[model samples]
Target: MKTSGLDVAPVNLTHGPACATCNGPTRLTGIEPHPMRPRTDLQTFQCLVCDGVQTAVVSLVH
Candidate 1:
């Protein structure tokens, strides 16, 4: 979709996880608190090269 005119390219995720589709870099797009877990979050990411989206669960218990 729409960005703030800021480029998402060159913004790689920490540890540099590759996109499953294009094997390109991904950037974190969004994060939200998990409904069922107070110490967890749902993270959304988008591939910079292919524009593919991915979601993941992150725990905040550390």
Candidate 2:
């Protein structure tokens, strides 16, 4: 079997019960980028209920 991208580390998914802004029952899915670029690494998440965008420094480990 071929495992190029498949071998790559997986992005962590965190669930947020409430929206940070509205405090509503919403979830935030965070994906940590590859650790090569720590500073550039960002956490991107979208609210399933409100469609809100939240970003943070999740971290990376090469």
Candidate 3:
């Protein structure tokens, strides 16, 4: 699915990233290119069970 022009994919709870605070499965809520890094992405996730939010910076492989 797409959100505000950003592509967001549905996450499988059983394999998705878990929340650090509650260990609950998180869904990808937002993503964009990192401001300071080339070929890198900044992603945001929200815990499905606890509504907790987290951000991650991932380097692109190619």
Clash count per candidate: 0, 0, 0
**Of the candidates shown, which would achieve the greatest lDDT relative to the real structure?**
3
- Candidate 1, residues 1-62: lDDT per residue as tens digits? 86799543353455345788999888888879999989898888888899888888888775
Q: Pick the candidate with the highest TM-score.
A: 3
TM-score for all predictions?
0.68, 0.44, 0.70
* lDDT digits (tens) for residues 1-62 of candidate 2: 86666445544355654567666554445556646765456666677667877776644344
Off by over 4 Å in 2: 4-9, 12-18, 24-40
Q: Which of 1 and 3 is the better model by lDDT?
A: 3
**lDDT score, residue 55, model 1?**
82
Alpha-carbon runs more than 4 Å astray in model 3: 1-15
Error of 3 at 33 (Å): 0.7
**lDDT tens per residue, model 3, 1-62:** 64697455554534458898899988888889999999899888888899998898988763
**Pairs that collide, model 2:** none
Q: Using lDDT, rank the candidates from best to worst.
A: 3, 1, 2
